[model samples]
Each structure stands twice: as C-alpha cells, then as structure tokens.
Target: MTKLLFIEASPRKENSYSSQVANEFLESYKAANPEDEIERLPLFETELAPLGMEGANQKMENIMKLMTTGSGIEPEGEWAGVMKEIERLKSADKVLLSAPMWNYSIPYRLKHWIDLVVQVGASVMVNEKFEYIGQITDRPLQMILASGSPYENRFPLESDGTKTDFERAYLDHIFRFLGFTDIRLIRVMPTGMPGPQLDEIVANAKKEAKEAAKAF
Candidate 1:
C-alpha cells in the first residue's frame, strides 16, 4: 500500500494558513486514493532534541561503522527516540511538509527535527570520489508554506525584505541533498494582509493545493 507522511510544523493548527491549505490537498488526495495510508507528524507535539556534541559524535561513529567494519561502535548518549523517527522516515513512500515561515526560516522545533533526521550515512554520504550521495528514502516532497508578507522572490538577498522565497531555496537544497528531486511548493503570501487580500490569497492557495494533489 502507498503511504503518505505529512509533517506539520505550524504551532497553530486550524488557525494556520499552511495547515488549512495543506488539509485541502490532503482531503482531495484522500478522495482520490481512499485506500492509501496517510500518517501525520505534528512537530508541536513531538519533543525533538537539539543536536549536541554527543549526538554528533554518535552520528559520526555510526557513519564510520557503516563505511568500515573494523569494530563495533557504541553510541554515547540516549538517541533511541531520534533514531526511531528517522527509521519511520526511511520507510515512508511520500512526504508532505507544511510550515509557516517563522522569522524567514523554519521553526526551531522543525529545524531540530531535521537535524535529527538528516544523519550522515543515513540521509547522505560522501562517496569514494568525494561526491555526495543521498541514502535516505527518496520520494516526492510537497511543501506548503505561509508567510506574513508577500514573497520576495525577485530580490531574496535584499535588506529589509520578506524571506519566503529564500526559505524555499534552503529547504529545496536540503531535501535534494537527501535525493528528493520532485518538489512542489504551495505558498500563501501576505498572510496578515487585510480585507479581500487574505481571501484572494487563500483562494489561490486552494487552487495550488488542488493542482498539487493531482500531480502527486
């Protein structure tokens, strides 16, 4: 059976634009594929530990052990919880990530979750020719993003500007590093824009979500 793993990064569930828009996609998807399994991972509900020296050390040791079988490696700290989440991701078939842009970046909790999941020799690795190779589960990824202001795609590096587009570049790079090449982005901009503007944005978001569901 096909499985879809949806990661929700917004603190606000029903109130969040990304959540609302992503649900549109999910609903349309389910209507089309009722037999498919849909799993959700709400970041606000998960306790993701920040990457520490011990976690880094354990990660590095695991990489070395995978590349070489000279000795049995021992992890120094508690990492069962993190590893379990990574294992879940490895076994998934499709991924959907929904988050509202916070200070021009992903939320701290989501970033921590990424840190725990993208481990060397697990998510990616350096090959003998010094080229990077992605080892994580490779599947299509759909990103639903919401921003307080309009997207600054034209001048992402400009000072005193919205950072929604810039955030996508970072997200795409990391996901691509993990061998995910099929990426679709649905963004709701000027989130707090007044009057009919918000409604118009939501309408556009709904259209995008519907299109993404068709493609996915």
Candidate 2:
C-alpha cells in the first residue's frame, strides 16, 4: 500500500478554492486505490518547531560532524522536531500539496514547514565537488494551486518588472531540489472573477483534478 502525504497549506478550509479542488483529487484517488494510506497534514493547525539560533547551530554541527567524522549525530531538543518532519517526507511514497496564492507567493506556514524539513544531511547533502545533492528521490508530487488573479499570461514576469506568480514556480523548484522527478500541477485561476465565471473555472479544475488523481 502506498503512503500518500497530503499537505494542506490553506487555512480557509472549505472556502479555499485550492482545498476544494484538492478534495476532489483525494476522493478520486481514494476510490481508485482503496487500500492506500493517506495522511493529511494541515500546516495551519500543525505545531511546527521553529528553527531558531539553537536549531541553526545544531544543523550546522550535524553537517560538520558528518563531513569530518563520516557520521552525523542524532538531533536533540527542538531540532528533533525538525528531523521528525524530514523523516515523514522521506517515508512518504507520494505527496500532494494544496496551496492558495498569497500576494503572488505561498503562505508563511507552508514556507516555515519547508524550511524545517529541507535540511542538510537530512533531505539534502553536498558532494565532495561542492555540488548540492538532494537526498530524497523518486517520489511523485502533485500540487493544486489557486490564484486570485490570472497570473499565467504574465508568468515569470509582471508589468512592473518584478517576478510574478511565485506560488507554483517556487514550489516546483523547491520540490525538484529535493529530487522529486514526477511532479504534476492542477491550477485554478482568476478566482477574483465574480459570478458564474469563477464557478465554471472551479468546476473545470475539479474535473481536471479527478482525472489526474485516477493515474496518480
């Protein structure tokens, strides 16, 4: 049985467009693979350990020890919480993330979770050649993204010269850095549109999500 980690990054719950579409995907996935395990991680409600000065120092110490002694020491204190999250990601066979765009980027809680897990000598490592190497590999990742504005047209660029739509783009890059080779996306856009247009868009996105989940 496959272990699928479903990370919900939006606090809006039932009202969140991204969560709505993600629910469709989950339903389809469950129907298709009844025996598979699905673990829901609600970032907003989760108590994540902050990586303060102590955690930072512990991380560097672990990495340095690994390099010099050929083995890293086990994490302790608040750093142990960070390690637990990293181990959770590593143990999952597949991952699904639902996130709504917040000022053209992902929510702070989601970013905080990412920071806690993506650690050196844990989720990632460095080679002798000074090249960064991702430790987690061969996992399938599916992201459901919702945006208020139509950011696709101006993708990678905004009228004012600053980069736009960092939500999906950042997620893609960061997950890839962690060595996820099979990454897929389901996007719901122009959520700022009023009336039936928004409804239609959401309906279409739900349909797409269901289709994607069948083969996921």
Candidate 3:
C-alpha cells in the first residue's frame, strides 16, 4: 500500500495557491492510485514548539534516556511530540510539502517543523570523520513551492541576475542531507503580479502538479 505524507504549510485555506496546487496534486494522485492512503498534516493545526537551546538539551537527554532504556517509545515532552510527526513521515512512502514562499524563504512554521524533523541520531547520523549521513532513505519527496515571482520557467533568473530559487535550494540541501535524492519540485510563481499573469501561472502550476502526481 502506498502511503503519502502531505505537509500543508500554508494557512490561507482555499485562497492559497500552494494549497490549491497541492490539492490538485493529491486529487490526481488519488485518482491514479485509488488505494493509496494520504495523510495531511497542516502546520497551522499542529502546534509545533520551537526547539530552543533548552528544548534541544531536553530532547538530547530524552533521546539518550530512551536509548539507554531501550524503550524506543516516545516520551512526554516537546521533542517527543515532534517525534510523533517524524514517525508519520517515517511510515509514509512519499512525502509532499506544499509551502508558500515568505520573504524569499519558507514559512516560519515549515522551518520550525523541519528543525524538529532534523534531529541528530534520529533523521541523521555522524561518522568518525564528523560527516553527517542521512538515516531516512528510499522515500521520494515532492515539493510544491508557490511564490509571487514566477521563476523556474525556461528563464528563472531575474533581469537583474538575482536568484529567486532560494527556498528550493535550501530545501534540496536539507532533503539530500536526509538521504532523499529523488526529489520533485513544481513551482507556482508570479502569483501577486498584476493582469492575467497570475491566472496563467496558476493554470500552469495546476497542470504541472496534475501531471507530476501520476508518477508521484
């Protein structure tokens, strides 16, 4: 049975283009694979605590305790709560993140969620050389990134030679660190632009999402 872990990072409901494209992607994916189980985790709905220094220490202590006790069961704390979300990802065959760009980066909630997910000795490991190695493997990650600037077409760079793909670059690095190399990214850009550009961009993104879902 194919399982999909869909992370909804946009809080703007039906009005969010990223959410709409994600819905389209899931709809098409479900139509193509009727038996697939799709799990949607809305970032706004799930209360995710920021992993400050104190929380990080607590998490490390909890992890070591669990390790020594050999329980491997989640404990009652902020870390364990985040671990539960990670467990969901671990159980899935595919992971999809529908996130809108905010200030040339991912949403704060998405960033925070990622911090919780990328824990040492959990999602990654270190060798004697101090090089990090990813623990999660095989699962393909699909990224539906929505930005107001239409980039990643035949011409992604701006006229001023500025790069607009910061979010994807950062996310790709993170996913690759977690041993996910089979990543798919589809963009919905120039949403805030005037005229028919927004509609045109949305339609193209929807089409891309629909097609990508077939193999997703």
Candidate 4:
C-alpha cells in the first residue's frame, strides 16, 4: 500500500481552488487504490512554534549527532519535533502539496514547516568536495497551485530578462533539493480574475487534476 501525504497550505479551505482541486485528486486516488493510506496535513491548523535559540541549538546538536554517530541514535529535546516532521516526509511514497499564491510566493506557515523539516544532515549533506546531496527517498512529488494573476499578465516579469514564476520556481527548487526527481505541477491560473475567465481556468484545472490523480 502506498503512503500518500497531502500537505495543504491554503487558509481558504473549500474556497481555495488549489484545495478544491487537491480534494478531487485525493478522492479519485482513494477510489482507484483502496488500500493506499492517505493523510492530510493542513498548515493553517498546525501548531508551529518559533525556532528561537533553544530550537536552533537543539537542531544543531541533532545534526552534529547524526554526522558523528549516524541515524540509529534518536534526536532529543525540541529537535525531536523537527525529526518527527522529517520522518513523515520519509515515510510517504508520494507527496502532494496545495499552495495558493500569496504575494507571488508561498504561505508563511508552509515556509516555516519547510524550515523545520529541511535539516542539514537530515534532508541534505555536503561532501568533501563541497557537493551537496539530498538524503530523502526519490519519489514523485506533485504540486497544485492557484494564482490570482496569470504568468503573462504579470507585466514587468513577462518583459524582464527572465520570466520568474515565484510560486513554481521556489517550490520546484526546494523539492528538487530534497531529492525528488519526478515533480509535477498543476496550476489554476488567473484564479481571482473577474468574469468567466476564472471559472474556465478552474474547470480546466479540475480536469487536469483528475487525470493527474490516476497517474499519481
């Protein structure tokens, strides 16, 4: 049985296009594979404490312990919480993340979670020649995104030297950093645009998401 982890970052819940589409994907995925275990983690409802001095110190200690003693030893103190999150990431056979664009980027809560889970010796490591390597399992990573404005509609960026897709670029890099080679993105673009444009986008997005569910 596959372990599917769905991480939702939108605070809008049912009102969010990304959330709605992701729900559709999960529903179809469940129907197709009855034995697969599906888990939902909503970032807005999660209790994330600030990573202050104590947490950072514990995190450093944990990383050092892993470097010196390896994986058998359990992490202690606040670092244990960080390790628990990483364990969840490692346990999943597939990962789906739903994120709505906030100021052309991801939500703060999701960023906080990323900061906690993406550790030095845990998620990645640097070799003697200074090459970095990600330690997580190589698996399929799927992302559902909702954007208020279409990529082309964002003027300055479209005309700029490089068309920078903040939402996709940031997430794609991060997931790649964690060793996920096969990553896919389903975008519901121009979501908050007026008239039938948004409806059309949403409809197309839903269709794509449904197809992706079966393939996922």
- Predicted model with the maximum lDDT: 2
lDDT of each: 0.80, 0.90, 0.82, 0.83
| Candidate 1, poorest ten consecutive residues by summed lDDT | 70-79
**Candidates 1 and 2 compared by lDDT, better number:** 2
Off by more than 4 A, model 1 = 70-77, 152-155, 158-165
CA RMSD per model (angstroms):
2.5, 1.6, 3.5, 3.0
lDDT tens digits, residue span 1-216, model 3: 889999999999799999999999999999999999999899988877657776688767755765576444354566666677667778989999999988777898898888888876677766669788898899899998888875553323456265455687788888888889899888887788756878888888999999999988
| TM-score order of candidates, top first | 2, 4, 1, 3
Candidate 2: 10-residue stretch with minimal lDDT: 153-162
Please report the candidate that would top TM-score against the real structure.
Answer: 2
Per-model clash counts, in order, read 0, 0, 3, 0
Candidate 1, 122-165: lDDT as tens digits: 66777889788877645889999888877744425656543435
| Candidate 1 TM-score over all chains jointly | 0.88
Clashing pairs in 1: none
lDDT of 3 at 189: 79
What is the TM-score of each predicted model, taking all chains together?
Answer: 0.88, 0.95, 0.86, 0.89
